[model samples]
Target: MTKDTMSIDTSAELLENDILPMIREVHTDPDVPCASQGDMPKALAEPVAKKSPAQWAYERIIMYIQNFEKQLDNDHEVGMGLAGGNTGVIRIEGLGYYDPDIVTYYGTSEAGAKTQLIQHVSQLNVTLIASPKHIDQPEPKRIGFRLAAGLERSEDVTT
Candidate 1:
């Protein structure tokens, strides 16, 4: 076989055997049901051939967030604690990744004001928390599944 073809085969083998396993091992939580490699959305899993670091981090984080939400009672929803200051937690309503570097979060602050945090992948530090759902609001919708679905749709359009 040609050198290029052999290298591509080696890369795919490494990703399947080494990288995916390490990700599963590191992110495994005893309390939450983590998504197995097989459970990864086709858009996210199949397109790993070319992705930015921020995109990779975003996809993995989405899986973890989805798993964490599964363990929450209806009375609680997922919130994210930002790093580096008195920046309070935000209810994670939406998440996005911008090409090679940025990860953006959209949600409401503790006081219920709309908020968004745009962060570099290098500085991304996330702490997912289960916060009490607002008294008047119905159970918060799980954003992870929605996000994954969006990825699928976008992939469909691109391909």
Candidate 2:
């Protein structure tokens, strides 16, 4: 078989033999729902041989953020609390990964000023918080979907 065919076969085998089984075994809090098989993006199902650690971390984080957002009410949006130091919370507006080992966040602070944080994959620690939506906004922003869509678009462009 050609190299591309071989790679496709390997990926299908891996998904059936490894990824699907593991996903089935995943457990979560009774009150908090997790991503179902259908909810997972296709990019996540297909394994990439040379994916960087940063890219892997970024994808997993996006999955988590998406799941968490599903548990929020319309009045609340996702915010991230940084660990260590006196760094405060930020409303997560955007996310990006730098190849090799870096993840970056762009958002607004508690005071509503623009903020950005960059961290190495090793030191990455994020606590998702439910912050109240702005008074003028009719509903909380569901960033998880947007972020996941962006990730898929980036994958499409790269491929």
Poorest 10 consecutive residues by lDDT, candidate 1: 150-159
Candidate 2: residue 123 Cα off by (Å): 0.8
Off by over 4 Å in 1: 1-21, 26-31, 47-49, 153-159
Off by over 4 Å in 2: 1-31, 151-159
Clashes of 2: 0
Q: Over the stretch 1-159, how does candidate 1's per-residue lDDT look in tens digits?
A: 776664445767776853442454444566546566446565565545477777877877787788778788899999999888877999999888888889989999999899999999999899999988989988677887677665566453122
**Positional deviation of residue 99's Cα in model 2 after best superposition, in angstroms:** 0.7
lDDT value, candidate 1, whole model:
0.76
Root-mean-square deviation per candidate: 4.6, 5.8
Q: How much does candidate 2 score in TM-score?
A: 0.78
Candidate 2 lDDT over residue span 1-159, tens digit each: 666664445766866654542444356656557665345676676555547778777877888888889889999999999999776999999888888899999999999899999999999999999999899999899988877775566355122
TM-scores of the models, in the given order?
A: 0.78, 0.78
